[model samples]
Target chain A: MPIIVNLDVMLARRKTASKDLAAAIGITAQNLSILKTGRARAIRFSTLAAICRELNCQPGDLLEYVSGPEPEAAEGGE
Target chain B: MDKIQRLSSRLRVLFLAGMVSVPVLHAVGWAFFERIMATPPLNFSSIFGLSWGEPPFMAGPATLAMKLLGFCSSMLPGAAAMYGFACLAGLFGRFGKGEMFSAATVRLLRRLGWAVLVAQGMQVLHGSLASLILTMGNPPGRHVVTIGLDSATLAETVTGVVIILASWVMDEARKLKEEQELVI
Candidate 1:
């Protein structure tokens, strides 16, 4: 729970729509939403690579680790 | 998937039939107890696995209390069978709808496993009670008490234990599948 997904921030910085990113990365919109919301248990390397290639960002730009417990609720997409 | 669906549908119907038939068969058997006991090969004692040194007979008259006790005794295993069949019907119905690994299916499997185990115990109880009821009308010296156990009972006990273990395994498998699905 200490690991946090910063996919929403990356999408915002790249000015990319979540649906468009999902389609480009060959994943469903719901799965993309799950990733953005930090609800996914883990992400596949292939999907990470596809997201990085499509968004022109590093994996580090999309993930972060916090020392404390996860927040009660995750703030997802716009 | 189609084959699984087809098989599940068929099994659901079969189990449903069993659920309905158990009580009906017990009712009919109780209704014609005397005649059925007289008949060979299909006699009540022969079918139910009870034996006595002398053939059991209904005492002076079939009183309401006697009939009630006999019916209740005979229906013990039948009731257990009905419970088991109902659980199986529900489990197969879920499978037919493609919910094989769902929690409801696992719950029904667990119930069915316990039902089988309970039914085996009920069979032993029924044998003892039926023997007592059938001989209750005889002279004090003629009363009988019989307890019967055969290889079939052992097989059934093993089968029930196996089913319970299978349900536990399936529950763990469901949890693993749910965790895997959460991964992207």
Candidate 2:
């Protein structure tokens, strides 16, 4: 996706580990990893807000729009 | 949830019944299937219970082969119909359980459609062959090779095609459901 997640960068800049940020944001570390790695399909407003509040960062700082080709679809076969 | 649970339970029972009914029906058919395909289509003694006479059982390879062919002809349609019903029962069970947009249901529907067509095809083939065998021994100018077809065959074939098309629709619906699931 062209709309990439920059959550790992924000977490790094704030000097917070992924586990600490996920706990502070009231989300599981697994979900935080999904968000950090840009694997989430869509983010809920409440979740984004909570993450922003916990990390003391704007949504813009957590998300970035980088012009790129569409991501390939997941492979499936019989 | 209560309603869905009840429906799924009922559908599951129905599916089981369908699976069992197929063989039972075929067994019953086997008992009388050959007799029903007798030369005159039904012997008078059997109708009147006059000793329940049997069709003149064949002795030669050709006649025995014809008998075997008749049995196959009778069993194929029954098998096809049973298979088709089994698929439908499975499909209904899935629907009742709220797995409406699923690949399994679509596959079942597709199989049901194909089964119906196969049953009809087997029926037509059997009918033509059975008729030819039964009437082949007639005197000169008695062999009438009629095409194996009837109103029921036509209707069943059309219904099968419609079912196949319904399966295609289900396939599309399943794809949409998959996309929606991936949207998170």
Candidate 3:
């Protein structure tokens, strides 16, 4: 995915634990881990809003768009 | 969900019974072939829609060999039915465990579909073979060869194709569910 999730960086900057953020955002710890590791297919707007509210940050601060070949395409080319 | 599980459990048991009974019933029918033909009400000729011809009264090697061959050929359809029933039992077992959209369930459903088609095809083949075997004891030039197709067989073929298509659609649904679960 070209779109990267910077949830770990935001959590660290806000001095928030992943478990506490998950509980506050009304999601499971595994789901929060999925978001942090960029394994999620897509995040719901409500969940994004909840995460932003919990960390006191903007959506842009949590998500970053980097230009590069897709991981699958890169693997296939090799 | 609980209701689905309960219903699935009951259906699983029913399919398991069918899986066990199919072959046993075929075996019993073959073992008492002459007696059943002698009895009007219990005659398989009416059930299978084929003339069983005159049963051999005296024991002969040729007649016994033909009967044995018929019995073995008859087991083809029974075995196919048993496989279909077993697949249904496994599919319902998964449903009972609340894995309704799992890949294993879809695979079992697909297998059941193929089994149904194979069973129907085997039935057609068995019918012709059985007719020849039953008439093998007749005088020369008096032998009978029969091939039959009824509406029931056609309906079963359509049902099998529909099941295979439904399993394909279920596979797509399973993929979508997996993707949805991955979304936070």
Candidate 4:
């Protein structure tokens, strides 16, 4: 499954450092990393709004649909 | 029964037995010791001096009933909570299913972490009360037992906090690693 964070792209487009982006978004750089890498299982609406506003991008820019594991192979392998 | 089920049952039985026996033994011992103390000319002072303190609590009459009930009410819940947590961890171990290093578990673990911090707050509250009671030089009634109760409660709380914090740290690291992998 390709889980796209779009953070690196967003940083490139805006010409913003990760540290500055994080500071502008009022979140710790570490938390920004958590979001950028798709390690987060869920994100708060407020945080999502904040990220969108700071990055000057829509929510779709931050998230991507990815194929999850194939169910038959997963069950059989398990 | 499966092996895990059998073991868990046995453990539960053993836990109950210990809980029943220890307090009963203590109560009986207290009674016997008090009886010996009541008898006159029992000048075996040196041998029993180690136990010499305020009048030993007796296990008879209405007073004893109240004391025993009060003691059990104060102490048993704390022991039960510890035992409950142990049983939970054990059950999880048996299934080969641990609290996964996942976001949900992390949140739950954080709650448990906060509980531990709250327990420490409780200890502080208890210590302040104990100090006040001591300085006031009031007769030791419920106040003395309160300090002892707080100590018992805090001990369990500390254990819970440690377990919660350990789990939280592990989960946090796991989350970070997973994030890194996504980046790669």
lDDT, each prediction: 0.80, 0.68, 0.81, 0.52
Native-to-model Cα distance after best TM-score fit, residue A21 in candidate 4, in Å: 37
State the displacement of the C-alpha of residue B153, model 2, in Å, after optimal TM-score superposition.
2.6
lDDT tens per residue, model 1, B1-184: 9899899999999999999988777767667766665676556562343644234554665455666687788678778889999999999999899887878888899999999999888888888887777778888887777787767777898999999999999998887777676688
lDDT of 4 by residue, B72-164 (tens): 432333334344444444433433333345665455455555555554554444343423322233344523322333454567677777867
User: In candidate 1, which residue pairs clash?
Assistant: none
Model 3 residue pairs with clashes: none
Chain B TM-score, all predictions listed: 0.88, 0.67, 0.86, 0.38
- The DockQ score of candidate 2 comes to 0.22
Evaluate residue A27 in candidate 4 and report its C-alpha lDDT on the 0 to 100 scale: 76
Top candidate by DockQ: 3
lDDT of 3 at A66: 97
Q: How high is each candidate's TM-score?
A: 0.87, 0.66, 0.87, 0.33
A1-78, model 1: which lDDT tens digit per residue? 788899999989999999999999899999999888988877899999999999999999988988987545632222
Per-residue lDDT of model 3, residues B12-90, tens digit only = 9999999898767666767777677778777765223253444433333345677577778787887888999999999
Q: Which numbered prediction scores highest in lDDT against the true structure?
A: 3
Evaluate candidate 2 and give its CAPRI docking class based on DockQ. incorrect
DockQ for each model: 0.46, 0.22, 0.51, 0.05
What is the iRMS for every candidate structure?
6.8, 6.8, 6.5, 9.1
Q: Give per-residue CA lDDT, model 2, range B93-183, as digits (tens).
A: 7777778778898999899999999988877765555555544556556654445466777998999999999999989888777654433
Off by over 4 Å in 3: A69-78, B38-63
